[model samples]
Target chain A: MAMSRAVLEGRAEDTDGRLLLLDPSDNVLVVRARIPAGETIRVGGGVPVPVPADLPLGHKIARRPIAAGEKIVKYGAPIGTATVAIDLGAHVHVHNVKSDYTPTYHLLGGEAGR
Target chain B: MTMRGWLRSDGRKGIRNTVVVGYLVECAHHVAREIALPFREEGVHVIGFPGCYPNAYAERMMERLCTHPNVGAVLLVSLGCESFDKRALERAVRATGRPVETIVIQGTGGTRKSIAAGRAFVAAQRAALDAAPTVPMDVSELVIGTVCGGSDGTSGISGNPAAGRAFDMLVEAGAACIFEETGELIGCEHIMAARAATPELGRELEASVAKAARYYATLGYGSFAAGNAEGGLSTIEEKSMGAYAKSGASPISGLIKPGDLPPRGGLYLLDVVPDGEVRWGFPNINDNAEIAELIACGSHAVLFVTGRGSVVGSAISPVVKICANPETYRRMEDDMDVDAGRIIEGRATLDEVGAEIRDLVIGLAAGGRTRSEELAHQEFVLTYKSFEPIGPACLPAA
Candidate 1:
C-alpha cells in the first residue's frame, strides 16, 4: 500500500501506509488503521516485514526486531520493556511487554475491564 | 473578548453563579442531596466530604470550594457528630461575603426539618444570586484547566495536542492555564522540567513527578488500567506521553497542588498527587475528583479531552469535552463539545480545532452552554489527601 500525500503532509516522520512513526527515535510504530496478518509494513524504506497477527487501529507494531529486556520506545521515550523477543512487525502489547515503573492491571485472558 | 460575569466580593469573576449545598460528612449527604434536588436545574449543586475523620487537606479543600468564584451562595449540612469542622467551613464561606447557612441534621429536628431549612436557604440564595450585579470579564481573567480521561491511542496525536494548542492560545491571550496528572507524567519529568521558567522551579517540577512515581509504585499500580491496554496503550509512561502533550509548548510558570490557584495568567502544573507518603489510596479515585480539584483551584471552565468518551460535566463549572478518536466521536457526538478527532481523520488541523476550543470557551463565558451543561452533567467528587505548603521555589516570585 502506498502512503498518501495527505496522511504524510503534516507528519514529520514517514509511515509504511499502515504504521505511523511518532518520533524518529521510536522503536515501534502506531497502527494508523487496522491491519490483517500477512500484510507487509516497511520501516525506513527497508524490506517489508509481514505482520504476525491482526493489528488493531491505534495498536503498535515493532519497527525492528526487539530482544527480550530491551526498552520499547514510543514518542521518543521508553514506555516499557519487552518481556520476550519480538520480531519486526509483531504486536507490542501487554502479553509481550510490561511497565518498568509500575504494574499494569488487566483482567484475566487479557480482556478489557475497567 | 469580554463577557458579563458574576463578580464576587473577593474581586474574582465567575462564569457561572452557583449555589452549592455541602454535606460535612457522609451522614449528612442525604439531607444535602435532598436540599439541592429540586433546584438541580437552577444551578444548585451538591458537594461534600464523606469522611468522618478530620483531615486538614479535606478542610482546606472545602474552604477553597465554598469560597470558589463561581459559588454565589453556600448551604452546609452537618450530621452534628462528624469530625469535619463545620464551623470553620461556614466561616470561610461567610468571609467571602456569599450568603452561607448551615443546618445540623441532629439539632434541626432530624432529616425532614434540616432538608426543609436547607431548601429554603438555597431557594432564597438562588433568587438573590439572580439579582447579583454583573461585571465585565476579560479573557485574561479566566482560569482554565485541562485533563484527559478515558484516553486511548488517538488522544495523544489528536485531542490532547489540540487541547494543548488551545492552552497555548489561552496562555498567549493572558489566561491562566493548568495541566496536571503527575502520576501519569512519570517518564516525561525531565522533558517537562526543561520547560520550567526557572532552574529552581524546574527542580521542583521534577521532584513533584518523582513523588507521583514513588506514590503510585508503592500502591503497585501505575494509574494504568485494563481499558488503556484495550485501547492499545501498553504502559503508564505511554499514556503519560499522551497526557503530557496537553500542556502545550509553553514555559512552565509554576507548580501547584490541588487547591492552589494560579497567581496570574500563564501555564501552571497542578500536582494532583499528595505530598509525603502514599496514605489515602489513589490520588484521584476518578475523573470527577480531579475535575472538582480543578474547580477548587478557581478554574472557570475545564477542557476535558477523552478518547474513550466520558460524558461527565462538573459542579460550579462547565466541562468542554474534546473527543479524540474519530469512531468514539461518532459514537458519542452529542456529549462532545469538540471533535478533535478531525485531526486524525485529516479533516481538520490541530490549529483549527484549537481555535474552535478557544472560541467555544469565550462563547461559554458569554452564557453559551456546553454540551455537558446542556445535558445537566453536574458531577462532583472529593477525597482524602495530604499536602505540605509549597516551597519558595514552587512559584518562583510569580
Candidate 2:
C-alpha cells in the first residue's frame, strides 16, 4: 500500500532508471525497459552500472554480485539459485540461474526439443 | 450495483443465458460444430470432450458445465459409439430443470440428419432463452475465478497483483473468488498455507502443491513453459511466485479441486492437479483448459492475466483480459480489457487498476461484453483427468 517516492513524483524512470527493485532484500531487479549491451544505466540511488548483455524488458538484472550456488532473491524470496557466479548488472536468467524446484525449459538450449 | 441475472432452478444466478451445444466425443465434433454454426452470433456456444473412452473426471466436468448457471439450455451431440455416457449426461442436465435434448449420429440416421435435428433443438431453445426472464442480482451472489498465463516479471509486479487486489475486493464484498493452478504455485505453498482459515486447510493446501510438484516431476516437465522462459522467467518457483500473486492477500478460505464449487463467499485455492497419478499427460494442456475448469467451478466470469499475451475466452464464461507488460498492451490493445502495465509505468497505482477490474466485472454482469466476447473468442478445451472428493477440512462452515 505504500507508494514509492519516485512513483508519487511521476518520475520512476529518473529515480530507479530502467531497473526496478521489487524488494530491498532482492539481489535482482526487473528491467522496466530494454537496455542494449554497452549502455550504462543507473541502479538504486542512481549508481551507474554497465549493461553486459542486451537485457530485454521484464528480464532480471543482478542488483549485486551473486556467488555460485547462492540463492537468487526476488520479491524478497528465493526464486532460484545462481548456477554460476553472477556479477552486478549482468543479465540473470535461465543460463546463469537454475530452479531448485523444477528444470526451466527453454527452446534454444534446454532439455526440451534438443 | 444490482444487475439483471438469469436465475437457474438451483437458485444460482448467471450474467449470461447462453445455449451450450456440446459434442460428447471427438467423433461428433464436426456435426456439433455445424449445428451451432448458424446460431453462433445468437449466444450459442460449442463445447465438447474429445476422448472416445469414458473418464469419470470428464463426465463430471461435462455435467457441471452443462448445468452451469450461465447455460440456459443444452443440446447434446453424440457419435453413438463413444464410451461417453450421453444418457447420464442428459439426465444430469434434465435434473437441473433446464431444457435438454440429444441427437445421436447413428440413431438420428446420419451426419446431415443429426445436424438438422441438433439445429432444430438449438433453434427452439435459443428462442426460449431469448425470452427468459432475468431477476435482480447482487455482487454477493457472484462467483469469480482468476488465472494467469504467459506470465513474466511484470505479471508479479503489475497484472497479477492488480488482479489479486480485485480478488481481495471481491472477497470483501462477500463474493466467492477462486484462484487456481497449484502446479504453478510450487514455491509459494508455505506462504499460501499460512493464509488458510484453518490449520487443517493449510495442510491440505501444502499437500496440493506438493502433489503438483510430484506430478510435474514424474512427467519431467514443470508448469513452466517455453514462452514463460522467453518472457524472462527463469524458473518454476519464480513463475509460481508471480502466479501466486493472483490470489491476493485475502485469508485462504478453502481448497477445492476442478469441478468443486466454493461453499461460500470468500477466497478459495483450486487444486487443479489430478489425484493418485500423472495419468493425464499434463494437468492442463493450455490456458483454455484451465478456464474451462474454472467455469465448471461455477465462475460467472474469469479474470485472465497475461504478460506475453493470450487471446482466449471461455465458452461458458466471459474472460476479462488484464495485460501486464506495457509493451505487450501496446501491441495487443484491442485484445485487452485493462492495461495493468500502467502500474509498472507509474501511470496508475495497483489500487486504481484493481478498481477498474472490479468495475469491469460489475459492468459485464449488466450485459456489457468483454473484448474477447466482441472478438468471438468462445474458446473451450477439456481433457481426461481424475480427482478424489474434498475432505471436511477443505471447506469448514463459517
Candidate 3:
C-alpha cells in the first residue's frame, strides 16, 4: 500500500531533534521530545521556528497558523477544531483544540497556558 | 511457516492440545478450579459459564470454547441442578471427537468426591491426547486477532499502526486476521468503511459502530478511561482514531459476532455489541472478554497491544503482549513482547517494528510461548449477554 510520504516517513529520525509532520496536509506537528521556551525547531521542512512556549512530549504544536474554529489536522485527519487562534510553533492540546465528539476534560484547573 | 497441529473432525487445526475442566455454573467453579490446579503443570486449564440461568448466548459461547481448536479434551463440572445444559455441552465436545466427561456434583457425593473424579478424568485425557494423531498446519490455516488495552496517546502513533501493518502482512500471507472493538472505533467508521472489500460490508461496519455508540451513550459512559485522559487523550473520538489503527490496510472481508468463525482466510471485524435491546450491561466488560471472544472464534493466539502496560493472557489461547509506550516498557519490560514505542523515539521505524511483530506472531504460532504464558497469566472471564443470530450478509462467503 503506497501511503503519503508523510505517513511513510513520519517517524524519520530528525537530526535537529524536533517535531513530526505525520502528513503533508497536517496542520499540527507532534513534539518529538520536550522543548523549553525560545528553542528553535524545524516545522514542516521550513526554516527553524522559535518555540513560543514549553511543550511536553507527545503534545501537538501548530506547524502553521490556525484560526479559531478551523480544524486541527493531525495524522492527515481532523482531530478537533482550534478554540482560539494558534500561531506557528504554539502548543496544541485540550486547552486550545476541542474534540468534535465530546467535551474535552482537563485534569488540572485551567492555569497553565499551552 | 508449517507447524504440527491436531487435526479435528470439523476440518480445523489446533496449535495446542489443551484439556479443559469447565464448570457448568458458579456452584461448581471451586471443584473445577481445584481439579485444574494440580494439572496446571500439564495443558489443563479451568473455564466455565458462571451464570446459573439458561442463556442461549452463554451456552453457545461455552460450546464454541469446548470445541475450540486448542482444546483436546474436556471435563465438565455440573452442580446437578443448574439450568445450564451439560448434555448439550458434552455433545458439542463429543461431536468434535474430543474426549468429554461430566461429573454431577450432587450425584458424586459433593465437592470432595467430584474433585477427585474430575482430576482422574483429566489425567486420562492427557494421556489420550498424547497419543492423538497430528497433522501439518499452514499459515493460511491460522486465525489471528488483536486488541488494545491501557491505550495512551502514543498508541495511535506507534503501537496500533504497527499492529495494523502486521495485520496487513498476515492478511497478505493468506492468514485470517481479525481486529475488533467497534466501541473504540466509533469515530473512524468513515475511513474504515472506505477500506471495505464490498460496499455492503462497509455499510455493515458503519452500522456496527453506530450500534456501539448508541449502546455506550445509553450506558451514560464512553469507553474512555481516566488513564486515557492522563495520557493526553481528551475525548472518545481522539482515542478511537488511535484505536482504529490496528486494522491495517487490508480490505475487510466480513463482520462476525462472538463464536461466529470467519468463513475464509482474510481480514474480518468482530462486532462485539449485543444485538436488539441493550440487555447485557456492557458489550465487553474488559479486555479479557474480548480476548475470550477472539479465542472462541478459533484464534490460535492473540496479539494484545497496551500502552499503560497490562500483564494478562487468556485461559486457552496464548497472548503476545506488545507494549506501545516507551516509558511503560521501561517500567514493565518483563511483561511485553514487542517494544513498539521505539517508533516514537526514532529507535525504529513502524515498518521495522511491524515486521518484528509479524515474525514474533509466526514464531508464537509455531509453538513458542509468549511472556504472558510463561508467567501463568491465564485470566478468564465470562458474563451474561444476548445476541441475535447473524444474517447471511454477515459472512457472505461462509
Question: Worst ten-residue run, lDDT, model 2 chain A?
Answer: A1-10
Question: Number of the top candidate by DockQ?
Answer: 2
Per-prediction RMSD in angstroms? 3.0, 2.5, 3.0
lDDT of each: 0.86, 0.88, 0.82
Please name the candidate that would achieve the greatest lDDT relative to the true structure.
2
Q: For model 1 chain B, where is the 10-residue window of minimal lDDT?
A: B222-231
Question: In candidate 1, what are the lDDT values of residues B295-361, reduced to their tens digit?
Answer: 8889999999998888999988999999988889889999999998777677887889989999999
Per-residue CA lDDT of model 2 for B1-398, tens digit only, reads 65879999899998999999999999899999999999887899999999998899999999999999999999999889999999999999999999999898999999999988988899999988899889999988999999999897778878988999899899999999999999999999998999999999999999999999999999999998788888889999999888988988899999988899888899999988999967889999999999999999999999999999998888989999999999999999999999999987778988899999999998888978999999888999999999999988999576
**Cα lDDT, model 1, residue A80:** 94
Q: Which stretches of candidate 1 lie over 4 Å from their true place?
A: A1-15, A36-53, A108-114
DockQ of each model vs. true complex? 0.46, 0.51, 0.33
* Clash count, predicted structure 1: 0
Pairs clashing within candidate 2: none
Better of 1 and 3 by DockQ: 1
lDDT of 2 at B264: 85
Better of 2 and 3 by lDDT: 2
lDDT of 2 at B225: 78
Q: What overall lDDT, based on C-alpha atoms, would model 2 receive against the true structure?
A: 0.88
**In candidate 2, which residue ranges exceed 4 Å CA deviation?**
A1-15, A45-47, A109-114
Give Cα distance to truth, residue A11, candidate 3, Å.
Answer: 6.9
After the best TM-score superposition of candidate 2, give how far the Cα of residue A68 lies from its true spot, in angstroms. Answer: 0.4
